[model samples]
Target: MGLSDGFARPLPTLVFAVAAALSMAGLELAVKQIALGTAYAVWVGIGAALTVGWAMATGVEPASPLKLLFIAGIVGCAAGLKLLPSGGSAAED
Candidate 1:
C-alpha cells in the first residue's frame, strides 16, 4: 500500500498496520544486537525494497527499469551499511 492510501481503505489498513507493528518489533530486537545505524539502515532499506516489490507483484504499481534500478540501489546501500567498519578501533596493549 502507498503512503496516502495505506490506512485510508479498510482491508489494506489492517494488513499494513500489522506489518508495521511487526517491523517495529523486529527493529527493536535488531538494535539490541547490532549497531543502531546498521540496524536502521537495514530496516528502512529492506522495508522499502520489499514494499516496492510487493506493490509491483500485486499490480498496485507498475514495474519499470528505473524502479528496478532503485531497488538495486537500495539493496546495495543496505549491503554497504552492513559491511562498513564500526567506529571502535583496536586497542593496543
Candidate 2:
C-alpha cells in the first residue's frame, strides 16, 4: 500500500500517456471538421455524456441525476459558445 508500487514497482505510466497522445489525433480531426465553435461544443457534450454512458455500459453505475446535470452544463456551454463573439471578427476591437 504505497504510492510507488501500483504497477510492478513504479512500472512506467508511459502507456497511458501514449494513448492520450494518440487520442488527440482523432479529437483534433473531429474538431477541425465541424469548426471549433460547434465541434468543440459537441465534443465536450458528447465526451461528458459518453463517459457516464461508458461507466454504466460497463456495469459500473446506473444512470443518475448527476448525469443529467452534466448534460445541462454541456447545453449551457454550447449556448454560451454560440452567443459569445467568435474570433477574427470583421470589426476591429
Candidate 3:
C-alpha cells in the first residue's frame, strides 16, 4: 500500500501501531523487574500471537489448523516459562 493509501491511513491501524510500540517499551521495563528469559519469552510470544490473530481476523492472512496449533505452541511455551518456579523473579547479577 502507498503511504497515503486509505488502508494505511486508518486511525485504528495507527492506534494499534502506537500500542505495539508502547508494549515494546513495557517489555524493557518488565525485563528489569522479572527474569529476562521469562519476560522476553512472554513478550515475543504475545506479540507474535497477536500479530497472527489480527492478520487472520482481518483476512489479511488465511488461518489453518497448523497455524492455530503453532500459535498454541508458542503461547504454551511462554506460559510454561511463567510457571517455572525460578524464572519468574528478578534476575541476579
Question: Each prediction's TM-score against the native?
Answer: 0.71, 0.44, 0.69
- Rank all candidate structures by their TM-score, best first, as comma-separated numbers: 1, 3, 2
lDDT tens per residue, model 3, 1-93: 223365567776677667868998989997886688779988889889988998899888999999999999999998887666663344541
State the local distance difference test value for candidate 1.
Answer: 0.85
Which of the two, 2 or 3, has more lDDT?
3
Q: Give the per-residue lDDT digits (tens) of candidate 1, residues 1-93.
A: 465384688777888788989999999997886799799999999999998898899899999999999999999998777766666643531
Candidate 2 at 91: error in angstroms? 21
Question: Highest TM-score: which candidate?
Answer: 1
For residue 68, model 3's alpha carbon misses the true position, in angstroms, by 0.4
Candidate 3 — which residues are off by over 4 angstroms?
A: 1-13, 87-93
Best by lDDT: 1
